[model samples]
Structure formats: structure tokens, C-alpha cells
Target: MNSDTRPLPQFAHAPLLLLIIAFLMMQPLSTDLYLASLPTLSSDFKVPLSTVQLTLSLFVIGFGSAQLVIGPLSDRYGRRPVLLWGLALYAVGSVLCGLAPSIELLILARFLQAVGCCSAVMIARAIVRDAYDPVHSVKVIARASTWLSLAPLLAPILGSYLQVAFGWRAAFAVHTLLSVSLLLLTFLRLPETNLHKNPGATNFAGLSHSFRLVLGSREFWAYALPGALSYGSIFAFISGASIVLIQVLHVPTAYFGYCFAIGVSGYLSGTLVCRRLLSRLGATATFRIGSAISLGAGTLFLAAVLAGFAHWSVMVAAMFLTLSAHGINFPIGQSGAVSPFPRQAGTAAGLMGALSMLVAFIVGSIVGATHNGTLYPLGLVVCALGLSIFAATRLLAPAEAAA
Candidate 1:
């Protein structure tokens, strides 16, 4: 590998890679690990299912919004301090969540936890951008994503067991412990990768200009919007899968996690395939392929729903296909979005994350609101989002070719 493509020299690549993967895993672990507990949470707090679901939407909102500030701060101050503080806050938030006595308190704590966890996510991307050039960054991100997907693969299974044995609070307790461990590892191991830190970037004027530049870039929008929609479709399933599977389709709660793991396996397979294909087909071709896969999967899912074959197997199969597409598209979209603004990597990563999470929040809320004891809402939203992804990619083809 070219020196520019390697990780920073002060740290060993293996250890640094592990740390970054750990950082990438936090967000998914935080959310997915407790998915099996949503019904339990609803019962515990004596709230309706929709109210319990708000906790997730709120987390997305807080997590997305926090990245807007954390990214700029990382650019202004340094990655290490921001990461350390974020992890500490995440630990505090997780502890509070574990002890929360009401749905209201739990929602607030989840938001705080999300805000803190967002730092690890956005900053991990920034660090990859900081440490490597665009080409290598994509590969690194793909590998990290493969590792990240494992969280979802295992989290639900582990969470189901926890919920079955120790109750929902155990999940938050685990999150607290993980956060503290990560904080210490970050403090001791992770180095300052923002060698070109712009102290002025924290100022309002500088921040505004950077946001404008990133938001104004046609290329970024072209790359990001489809990926965000794809992500939103997957999150729609995440937000509603438990209800659909456990309540509607009547899958046993214990086995629900195993079925969920099947979808994550698709994502893992896609990322592994993406790693190989990135070298051969390059990002644009690979991205198009992923989008097409998602569109096709969405179409099939809708057709199945329309045909009244909305079984657990059908839902799992559709989710597997859609998530696989996401696995392929996400790293490529992220790499493409940040590639043009190497100097403002933090801002770019943050904005992209914000857009993606905003889409998630919207989709989650929609699913929560429209859920009517069937998979219709999930199918409709996912299919529509997939169509949007396909159209966006087609519309952007000329611009991509010119670039």
C-alpha cells in the first residue's frame, strides 16, 4: 500500500483497525441490542407500542443532530478529546437509561446516549478520512462495515437472551460497560489523526461556510441521497420488525433474533462482496449495482405484501436482500460524499450522517404511526424509498459520468 493509504504511523494497523471497528460497532450495538426488549419496555412503562417506538425515533434525531456539532468541534479541537468526552457521556446516559423508571425518562436517556454515541460514529469516519486517501478509505470503511454488521448479527440474539433472563435493563448495563471500556481504550490507544485541524472551523462563520460548501456540492447529494434512502428503508424494518414479526406474523420472541440475524448475514455477505468488487468494478459501478439490488428487493417485498404472503419468512428474505444492498452502498456513498472535501472531512462525514439519520427518523416515525397490525406500512415505505433510490441514481448518472 502507498504510505498515504496506510493508517497513521504511530499506531499499528491491526490495533488501530480494531479500535475503529469497535467505534463503528457502538451505534448498531446500542440500538439493535435492545430491539428485542421494545415490547417489554412497552409493558414495563404501561405505554402503547407507538410511544415506546418514539424512543428510537428520538435517538435518531438526537444522534443525527449531535453529529452536526461534534464534527465541527472535532475539526476545531481534535478527534481524541471529542471522542473521549462522547464516550464518557454515553456511559453516563446508558447508566441512566438502565435505571429509568418511566418511559419519559428512558426516552430522554436514550437521546442522550445517542448524542454521545454519534461522536464515535461520525469521528470514526473522519479518522478514516484523516488517515488515508479516498481509495484506501473506501476499502477500510468496507472492512469496518463488515465488522460493524456483526453487531446486529449478534446483538438481537444476545439481547433476546438478556431480555429473557435478566430483563431489558441488562442491555443498557452492557452498553455502559462497553462505553467505559471504549473510552479508556480511546484515551490510551487512539492518536490525533486530525493533523490539519483548523482551529477557526469552530467559529460560526467558518462552520456556516463549511456547511454551505458541503451542502452545495452536487456530487455529494448525488452520491448521498440514494444511500440515505437505502438506509432509511433498512431502518424502517429495524423500527418495526419486532412488531411485525412477534405480533403480526406470530414468530416466537426467542426465535425472532435468529430470523433477524439472517438479514444481518446478508449485509455481512454484501460487505464482504463489496470489498472484493471495489477493486475490480470501482465505486460508481458497485454503487449502481447495490441500488439496483435494493430497488429489486423492495419491489419483490411490496409484491409479496400485496399478494398477502406477509409471512415471517417473506419479511426476513426481503430484509436480507435490502440490507445486503445497504451493505454494498453505504461505504461507497460515504467515501464518495467525503472524497471531494478532504480538508473538511469531519464536516462532510457529519453532514452525511445527519442526512442519513434524518431519513431514518422520518421513516421510523412513519412506521410507528401507520403500523396497523400488518406489514403494509413497512412494505409501502420501503418500496417507495427503493424507487426513490433507483430514480436518484438514474438522474445522477450523467453527472457521475462527467465527473
Candidate 2:
């Protein structure tokens, strides 16, 4: 169907918005909820922190790579079927993750779980495109992201408690249950949103063309680069924070969630700020401010660590500032990247999401590899990603504003 020429609905129904928020939450929920268990996992499996880190880095690899296919498959078939199957796979993978006896097995399971969970996030953006015009979709995504931040805010806290009470594997048990529940909800309540299905989307030539169409657009990279880097900064924290907070700084494992929650609260706050800024300033202006905050916060963080202020509070505070900026940049980035390709929204969403995860995987690997039992590496990564985000914004904002 030629949806490119048609006017999309101005807004999505309220129920669908809830589903989208819930779907989007899967990504954070998958990682953050078990983050507090990283140390415990390392101890239990008789492995080093770097080996345990593989679970996360590999999950990003699977999640990012799968979206390349899932998004196109949704565009070829429809969002509903793909989502249903994805949730089911997630449930199975979660179960496997909980049952695995070895770190290697757990890493493999995480990759599987990630592959399934990718559908929720990638399709959520596509559905937004199906329902709204580009400009309006940005507003909708930003507002939804405000609610979505709650996952990261609460997941770690909940995970910490769950770890103390039952064990690290409890997180996967919860994931299994949640995935099943979401699966039922999808099957019963979620309607098909991809009305403009392109039969050729899954074909090799068609997929390549769709990719080129999105990639060739200057607008997509402008947002995608900043978005990926901001997320990379956050991932740097996610992959490294537990060790820093619990091992180096001597924070209690049980208390780690509260500290993590404080940083994530920045994301919630940033999303609120994002909605306000978008109303008054527009996308390009919002990007500029957000990127500046990210760069400035990252610099302060690295400087603090370098000056021998290697405190958990410093790390958490720095994360809070940078992630708050992420809250601002991410929605704008996602909407902007997909905006130019109405008919190729799934392809655009997938490609953008893939880039974010790819950057995250690289960042996570670096953090893992460079862990010298000190704060310097994490600080360097966050600062470098922030600088990159600022650079990308500077290059794109003027052009976007002019356009």
C-alpha cells in the first residue's frame, strides 16, 4: 500500500500508547533489572567480571543485529505477528537464561532473549509512524519516553531486592513471567498497526534498497549519531557501574539499586525537560541543548575521576547528568531518523536502533576490556561519547534548522 502519500492519523489510541510504552520498556527492563546481580553472577559462575560482561555485550550484539531483520519482516508481513512471535521467543530465552549453569550458556541465552526483545522496541517506533505524521510523532515519542524511563528508574532497585531475596537468576524468572504476560496482551489486545506492508521488504534487494534510502538521507545520520553516542554513554555506565559501586567504592550490593536509580532518575527528568523544550524550541534547538548538556556533564565526570574523586556519588551524579541529556536526545533522534521515511518507518527504526546497540556493544566491550579496577576507563568512555554527541549535533543542527 502507498502509505507514503497518505495522511497518517494525528494520534494513536490511548491503549496503544500504553502498549507502546510497555513494549519500549522491555529493553531497559531486560538489562537494568539484572544489573545489580553482575557481581553475584561473576562470583557464582566462578568467572571474572569481563566474562560476565559478555552476557550484556553479546545481548546488544544480538539485539542490534536482529532488528535488521525484525524491522523489515514487520514491514513485509505486519507488526502484530512479528511481535507475538518475538515475545514468545523472549519468554523461552528468559527461561533458558535462568536455567543455564555456565556463564557461556547464560551469554547465549541473553543473546536469544535480546533477539526476541528487539521486536518490541523496533516495532513500537514503526507503529508510532503508522499512527502519526513525522512532527507529531516526535511529540508522541517524547511523551511516551517520559513514562518509559520508569523501567530503568525502578528495575535495578527491584533487581537488587530480588537478588538479595532469591538470587540473581530471579531476574530472569521475572523476565519470563513478564514476557508471557506481555505476549498474552499482545495476542489479545494489540491490533495490527502496519497497514502499509511492503511485500518485498524481506527480499535481499529490497532490504538493501530500504537501508540505502534511510542511510542516504542526511537527516537520519544527524540524529542517529547523536542518539547512538548518548546511548553508548549510558551503556558505559550500565556495564561498569555495578563493579564501581559495589567493589571499588564498597557500597552494599543491596543498596546499589538506589544509587543506580538516582542516575536513571535523570532520564525521567530529562524526558520531562524534553517535552517542554520541544514545545518551545523545536527539534534542532532541543538537540543542541541536549548535546551540550551531555558533553559538559561528561567532561565534568571525567575531570572529577581524574582528580582522584573516585566516589560512587560522583559516578552516579555524572551518569544522572549524561542520561538526563539522553532522555532529551533519544526520542528526538528516533523520531527524526524515521521521519523522512514514512513508508520505510520499520526499516528506519530498525537501522537506527541497530546503530545505537552497535555503539553500545563497542562501548561496553571497551569498558570491559579497559577495566583496570579503577574509574578512569569508564570516565574516559563517557566523556568521549559525550564529545562525539556534541560534535554530531553541531554539524547537524544548523542544517536541520535551515531545512
Candidate 3:
């Protein structure tokens, strides 16, 4: 249990681990808990499906863009203050989202919420990099993900019930409650992990140099891009699944969460498996395995969809497989990206997060725009992402070997 030891002085490993889980889980909680409400939002707002879809794409864009600032700020000012302010903003944004009267307002609120959420996410990864060496950080991330999986696993089920009983607004209410609670917990329990704060990290000249160093690294892209592409495939499903299942395949809205849960089970399973794989195979080998799985799953999904298998079961099965791969790749990609730059871990983590969210925004928007009452758009987008993941894996192999 070696640690970098820059964390809160008196904090025990157990409590710190729980805090990490809480911080990282915010990402899934923010999105998954409200997913079941998407179609309802479309109908209630009298907007086209694509218009409603902006709530997601716009959220992703904000999430990505905010990290560019939040990461550097954390490096300059330390993670604690940045994180505290971000949580406060998230709480306010969540309340606004719940009360939004129009679809436009809801999208705006979601974007604001995303900016706040990015701070928790990027800082969590930066904390891991700060506390542990590379291999240990990967294992810690996998362990944390084991618990983090619970959010996506349960949130949709909870959300569907909320959507049915209390309407779509209930989901945002939950977000508001969770954000405030987490904010209190963070203020009380979390400590500043960025002890070696860089005074110039947020300055224009310094920020540009940090960007060039992180982006210029072959190792960062080698590890980061697969996770980003894998996440893009998952976002494709998230963006399109409700329309495909509820509208085209005709699954009942009430049962949609159960279907989603079943698919998320694959991710849970992958996280559990990731822990074992890391112990036996290490990060590089395990990452390769995950990449191959994504390629196969994506190819199969597109093939099945193109061959006219429009059943909800087919889509769910593909979701399961692709997400399983993501569960395996994400932690490793995230950790590996930041491992090289100990002094600049915050900047590196933020940049890596920005890349993934940017990919999600692009993939999600394309899925929305190309929707035509069929599974074609989802299938095409997912398969393309899978191919991209495979390419990234190949590109990263040499870099990993060199390291």
C-alpha cells in the first residue's frame, strides 16, 4: 500500500477510497439517473427528438470544455477549492434543471450541471495519480469502479420509477439532492491532494505549454484514445437507445430500465473481471484484451442491426458487450494517460477527460442527427467507434512497449 502521500494528512485509506468512489460515481449518476426521462422530455416540450437530444450532447460538450479549465485551475489552486466550487455549481444547476419550464432551459441547465460534474470527475483521477504509482493507480481505479458500477446499474431503474411516479422532473430532483449531499461530504471529509500546485498552470503561456506536452505524448494518446472511443460507442447507445427501444422496437417505457440494467450488468461484470486481469496480466495486456472485445462487439452489433435484427434484445445484447469492454478499458486508459506526468497529473487527467467527452458529444450528436426511425444510425456510429478503438490500440502498442 505505497502512496504518494500528498492527500489529507489524517485520512485513512478506507475513507479516502470511499471518497474516490463517490467522486467518480458522479459521472454515471449525472447522466444515467435521467436517461429514462429523455423521450418523455421530447413529448412534453413538443420538440423533435433531435432537439431534445441536445440535453445530452450539450451536456457532454460542456463537460469536455470545462475540464480544460478546471484541470488547470486545480493544478494552480489545488483540487480542494476547485472541487468545492464545482459541487456548489452542480447543486445549483441541478435545482435549475428540475425547475426548467422549457426544453431549451433544461438543456442549458444540463450544460451548467455538466461543467460542475467535470470537476469531480477529472479531480478524482488526478487524485489517484497523486496518491499512487502507475500500476497501483490502475488497480485502485479498477477497485473503485467495482463500486462505481453500482450507479449505472441502479440509477436507470430508480429513474424509470421516478419518471413514472413523479414525472421527468423527479430525476433532476435526485441530482440536486445527491449533489448537495456530496458537496457537504466533500467539504467535511476530502483533503487537498495537489500539494505541489503549479502557480502558472492556469496562465495562458503555461496552459498552452501544458497542453502541448500532454497532447504531444505518444503514451497519453495510446492509452487515452481507446477509452474515449469505447466511451463514444456507449454514448451512441445512450443517445439512441430510448428511441430505438421504446419507439421502434416497442419496449414498454416502464420495463426500459430493466433492459438498461441488464445491459449495464455487462459493465459491472467487466469491472470485476478487470481487477482480476490487472493482478494477473497487468495494464497493457488487459487493455489489449478490452480493445479486442470492443472491436468484436461493435462489428457484431452493426452486422446484426444491418441484417434487420431490430429486436430490443439485439440492441440490449450489443450494449452489454460494448459496455463490458468499456468497463475494462476506461480506468486503465485514464490512469495510463496521467501516469507519465506526475507533476502535471491534473492537466493530463483533465485533457484525457476532455478528449473522451468531446468524442461522446460528437458521437451523440451524430446519432441524433442521423436518426431515421431505424437502428441504422446507432449501428453505424457504434461500429465506427469500435473500429476507431481498434486502431488506437494498435497505435498505442508500440508506445506501451517502448515504455
Query: Highest lDDT among the candidates is held by which one?
Result: 2
Off by over 4 Å in 2: 1-14, 398-403
Q: Could you tell me every candidate's TM-score relative to the true structure?
A: 0.97, 0.96, 0.96
Q: Which wins on TM-score, candidate 1 or candidate 3? A: 1
Clashes of each: 0, 0, 0
lDDT of 1 by residue, 3-95 (tens): 434685654444667888899899889889999899989888899999999889999999999989999999989899999999999999999
Model 1 gets an lDDT of 0.88
Ranking by lDDT: 2, 1, 3
Among all windows of 10 consecutive residues in model 3, the one with the lowest summed lDDT is: 1-10
lDDT of 2 by residue, 218-307 (tens): 889988889988899899999999988999899998999999999999999999999899889988899889999999999999999989
For each candidate, the alpha-carbon lDDT, in order, equals 0.88, 0.91, 0.87
Candidate 3 accuracy as lDDT: 0.87
> Could you tell me which residue pairs clash in candidate 2?
none
